[model samples]
Target: MISKLELLDNLKEDTGQLWGKMSAQHMVEHLIYAVRTGNGKLNIGCFNPPDKWPTLKRFLLSSRPFPREFINPIIGENLFPLQYENLEEAKKILEEEIKDYYRYFEENRDALLLNPTFGELNGSEWEAFHEKHFTHHFSQFGLL
Candidate 1:
């Protein structure tokens, strides 16, 4: 297992040559989008229904397999689509966001945020999801 900081640093070395699709710039922007969620600037979805709240909560808290459909996104929402230009600028933005996310995780290990989809999570879950999900994509790009 790699430390979060180490994994982050390693991201700088990944050139996105093997991602097969996204340019390095897009990958960096995707990372930024995830970190922005923790920073309270991005909302995953608009709202949750009362009837499905428990199901949504369980999905967030439980160790269930993520549906394959969630892999691709549809646009026209608050969520930013993963596409970017200017590789150097995107890398700089991503690096700064990751640093901010790391500090937030360290300081707010038990705080709750109103996640648009998951409802809320303590800091650990937030950090775990962010790290794991980011690593998943990075690996998809052959970064690891």
Candidate 2:
């Protein structure tokens, strides 16, 4: 598993040349939104029960991928941010969210957490999904 610190460090690098998608700043904001969703702070505007997930998606969510889409991404406007600015501040907030996520998982790994897009995810499932999803986006922006 990639260390969270390492992932954060990579975010400092310029991604404009590496991934012609979102600016590194916007990318950081995007990351914040993701962490918030996992922590029960933000809702992605949809729901997918754990049973509704495909076998492949459930499996892949538990580990790092060889970089293909990593895992199937859900489609919805509310799941992601429509806009953002100030990459530095966004990164700081994102880092905080990640820490909170880790703490939450550590404390409640066995508890059932309500997921906006997956009804209720047990602690392990949430960790796997959060980690894999973050890794996927980090890789997408060339920061992994």
Top-TM-score structure, candidate number: 2
Q: Give the TM-score of candidate 1.
A: 0.62
Candidate 1 local distance difference test against the native? 0.59
Off by over 4 Å in 2: 12-14, 17-20, 49-51, 54-57, 62-85, 116-119
**Model 2: what TM-score?**
0.66
lDDT of 2 by residue, 11-80 (tens): 6536552433455675667666667766767765545656665654555464545354223244333335
Query: Clashes in each model (backbone N, CA, C under 3 Å)?
Result: 0, 1
Lowest lDDT block of 10, candidate 1: 68-77
Residue 45 in model 1: lDDT = 59
lDDT tens digits, residues 1-144, model 1? Answer: 125434445554346545335555565676677677776667675266556766776665566544422534423323455454565677667777777766766777666665555556567667656655665666755655
